[model samples]
Target: MSPPVTAPAGRKKTLSHPKKANNMPRQPRTFKAFIVLCAIALSSPFTTPATQNAQAQQNRAVQNQMQNDPDTGSKKGWWSGLPREKKMLYTTTASAAAIAVWGLATWDYGSSSGFHTAHEGAFEENAKYGGADKMGHYFATYAISDMLTGLYKSYGYDTRKANNYGVLSAWAVQAFMEIGDATSESQGFSWEDTMMNTLGALTSILMARYPALDDKIDLRVEYIANVRIGGIFDDYSNQFYSIVLKLDGFDFIKNNFLKYLELSAGYYTRGYDTDEVKKRRSVFAGVSFNLSRFFYQKHYNKTGKVLEYLQLPYTVLKGSRDLD
Candidate 1:
């Protein structure tokens, strides 16, 4: 299972500064580097025909073993032989408790006089971090649900049961976090965030119920490595939240060169962390190599799984339209 990318649940104020004058000139050079790197990745030994064929054979053998081996059933009870629902209940309770403790310590929860609400605008030009934070909320819940689905499946739950529990667990956990925010001195519950979280959990349920849809689309976050002082999860200026459409998901494209390509559209904000006077919100569309599929083809299954939720930086060439 892929790890969930946690989103920050609190907001912090920053001092405003002037925008950089020479920032525009660096983009072309950066894109040129990206193109070169992508070219190398495509032609690398990992994608060679021989390597792919060998990997396919290895994967098939592994799948056959899992299906036929009686030992697999015995191994299912390796974790204390607990019932499925009991495992789920314990896991969810523990996770929520852990998050609550962390929030109370770091986010100033319970420091406020009373419960409160915040009216953070959604996707508006002037909204906090130009609404990048909203997308973070969405992606966090979506990823959490997906991760929980895998966990529940391992706990011996059927597919439908696992997915439902995953969705509900994710929603509950996020709602818990938001409620904690309502009691915080530095933050308050925002309906907009809750709405996005609900949508994300719903999307996860839909995708889990439909394998073809899951294969076709992904919600991924691309993080640019920078000398930023904070954790990557909360670095809105260095993150792009993207919806990727894999061309290989279609039968017509699966056998062709186009299978290695994907289409992406995403949003990101610039100068938000530094609180520049000219904060920019941009929406972008681009073509990216389907590296996750490539890794799967090469039998790097774990890496492929991670890439499904995390977009590798410098793997795309985007043309962005500034919204602000």
Candidate 2:
């Protein structure tokens, strides 16, 4: 065999052994690993020390709720009556922490604070200039609303609303930030941000109202009869089209508006990603407790329902009844 033909220097010599098949597929390239690492790095600074502390409190609440309703899956109360001072401290601290995260995320590490990011108006402007068809628009809206909802829920606000409080809150928070940004030296009011915020808030409200719809569905599944989540992704679709008409000046999806609605029905339901979800739930519980304390003390301090609410978890756990 002429002393076993030598292989090329750079390439592997696996072919030298005939028994080892070269047909085995090459190892798959994985950007997933890079994406995960980047995500961690990006999200890390956003979790402030104060936020972490609040998240701990929220975790305790969730654990208590779970113990109280191992099968019921109903949330238990924890902050029926904290003092006014405590409540204010809680809210101020949590809000400041969230704001810090937002500031840092938007901050430029290089200069103190400039009028533009390196890419300047290109990415944000194009996202706006391109109109409502872009995924960045959707992501922006979803991220803001989702983050707000998570924060509010963490603070202990019962957001299950028939009216528009949730949207109001979402819009209020985002619009305020936008106003601040517009007044700033670097970034001015991009119609894109406004349109995106409006769509996101409206989407959240609409979805909250009609929890079961199919066509615009992102994740369509039911955890139980009447109890479901992620059915009305169309609400966001509606907001998109509306913005298209208002800002982008388009109406292509207009005709199919009615047909676009969709409803989902199922037995099993998948939840959010494990780590983030858990952290979110903790944040939700902490905020909930803090807010509850403020509200209860303001309204029912004399009645002493605060203690009642705190013990409510224990009662629910002991009762082991189905969620109402």
Candidate 3:
């Protein structure tokens, strides 16, 4: 059946010409349906590519804000210089303690029996199994600690200063060992050891340099475990354990047991070797003891807490328990 067609609004109702009467153009059903569909598509709220991109950008901006916010991580307070006299006193004490402990422990191993047994086997074993080939594990560890402690004192614990203290420490260690190589007739240094020490120092320095960025960066703990592993050999073991015990104070043994336990946990956890044993061994082998130094500084001095207590000046405790 044919449908009746309507004429244009301004056209006459009937066409007089034969050509116009039968063959006049008419809209197809397909074309009419397409026009209706197009109108519906245009009216929809579905976003275009540009709008989607804008929305994606907004999401990324939100994520960035959450990541960069200071609240997401801790920050150090303004610079507080360590008093010169105090710094000198602490440095002298720390150096003396370190030297005494190293000497006493190494000698206790019976390596000091006229020929230096402590240096022979331990040094050999460290050279073979340890990541670097030159210096023995103990020597390396001592050197690293000494260098880093010097860095801490040099900066006076100022967090405001750029934190390349680690790198500075590492370089110092390298330089000192190399100088030892040149100067010491009995204990000549090896280039291999020097290079390895450099590598290890770089890792510590870089980590310390970008502490904020490196906070969550986890490495295999076993790499530093060499410090504890020395315990397997009785002489070295006693020395380390005794030092830690003494640091807690002989009088306060009971009170400091928990602290000692925590130190042990740190030593073990960081030293446990898995896949990271190889990589971290080279990087962290000599520097593990520095962790102990860090602990001593933070806890022993209680610098932050001391500053806070000083700032209050006891006024806030006017009616407090201490006053009572």
Candidate 4:
């Protein structure tokens, strides 16, 4: 072989490095206006007279219960005297503030020259992370609603009020985040994300109104270890979005061995972080032991609660079909 090549006498040689995969920019904040819209939406869940009349009767029953319940009258904490709406406002505001700070510090919020919009294809096989980000939006709002429902109930709000406030709070918080994204240099407001957020919040309300449904189905995220990208929430390559149906939810199955099993359907993407040319989107069906139910049976309630939203790896035996 010939001698190794070299730069000309007067020129300097430059070294080239492999390019890094671009992480999707972090995602929001017209809160006051959005709150008005949320209120209008919440005020009318049904349009027909018969359904409206039924809802009115239900509301009156809830009010009667609250008026008669001794626990509702008890003063247990410093904020007990505050109105439930004010409590919800304060809590929502605090959550928004925390998210704003996080966005500013890590997501470069307000660094853009002006507000903008981005068209992130929703659940399209070719979209970024094969639409894992959309699932992220859905999961975030759904989880937030569930947590806020518990909070509102603890604050003495009745079931309907608590469910309504939870959805409202979750929607408002997500809308604020999207508004912030509009101002970020590396991110833009995404209508698809907003739509997913709404779906998530609505699902939460549906589950709250029907405990049996909640017990039967779960929307969850599963994370497997991989190279870090931005943060855990931003690590799409390692994450899977799953919709699980638990046999334990059925009365007959609950008394049999099948109760310890669960079926899951999910979507995930691969090679987005390091190999765009070979990126793949896949849909999967899986069977997994009901670890959440196991935790509940062991009386590890807190662990069970966490498992409800997060699927532990190595627990699922899955088969996947590539979308592209």
Tell me, by TM-score, which candidate is best.
1
Higher lDDT: candidate 1 or 4?
1
For residue 6, what is the lDDT in candidate 1?
47
In the range 1-324, model 3's lDDT, one tens digit per residue, is 000000000000111221122353211111121222223223322222224466457647855865888553234332323453454446345534543353234212122124210121212323222221222222232223323333343334432231244234334534443332233222233344445456544544554455443232222112111343322221111111001111222334465433333111111111211233532221111111223324335553222111110111111111111100
Candidate 3: clashing pairs of residues: 111-117, 111-118, 221-270, 221-271, 222-271, 222-272, 222-273, 225-271
Model 1 stretches with alpha carbons more than 4 Å out: 1-3, 7-78, 226-233
Clashing pairs in 4: 28-177, 28-178, 28-179, 28-180, 28-181, 29-179
lDDT of 2 by residue, 109-188 (tens): 12223332111121222221122222223333433343333334444443453124334544554444444344323333
Q: How would you order the candidates by TM-score, starting with the best?
A: 1, 4, 2, 3
Better of 1 and 4 by TM-score: 1
The TM-scores of all predictions, comma-separated, are 0.77, 0.32, 0.29, 0.74
Clashing residue pairs, candidate 1?
none
Task: Estimate the lDDT of model 4.
Answer: 0.64
**C-alpha positional error of residue 186 in candidate 4 after TM-score superposition, expressed in Å:** 0.8
lDDT of 1 by residue, 1-324 (tens): 222444222233211222122221100011221222233223222222334467557757865976899676567545545767888998788778976887676666686688866776877786756777778777777777776776676565656787799789878977887798787545667788889889989988888777788778988878787636354434567778899999888987647789888999999888766646788999999999989888888877555766777788788899999985
Model 4, 1-324: lDDT tens digits are 000000000000011212112443332111122223223323322112223356558757866977888676464566866787888899889868976886688556777678866676776665654676677677767766766665676565766787788778878988887787777655667788788889978888888778788789987777676755554434467777799999988887646679988999999877754445788889999999898788767865445655776688668899999988
The model with the greatest lDDT is 1
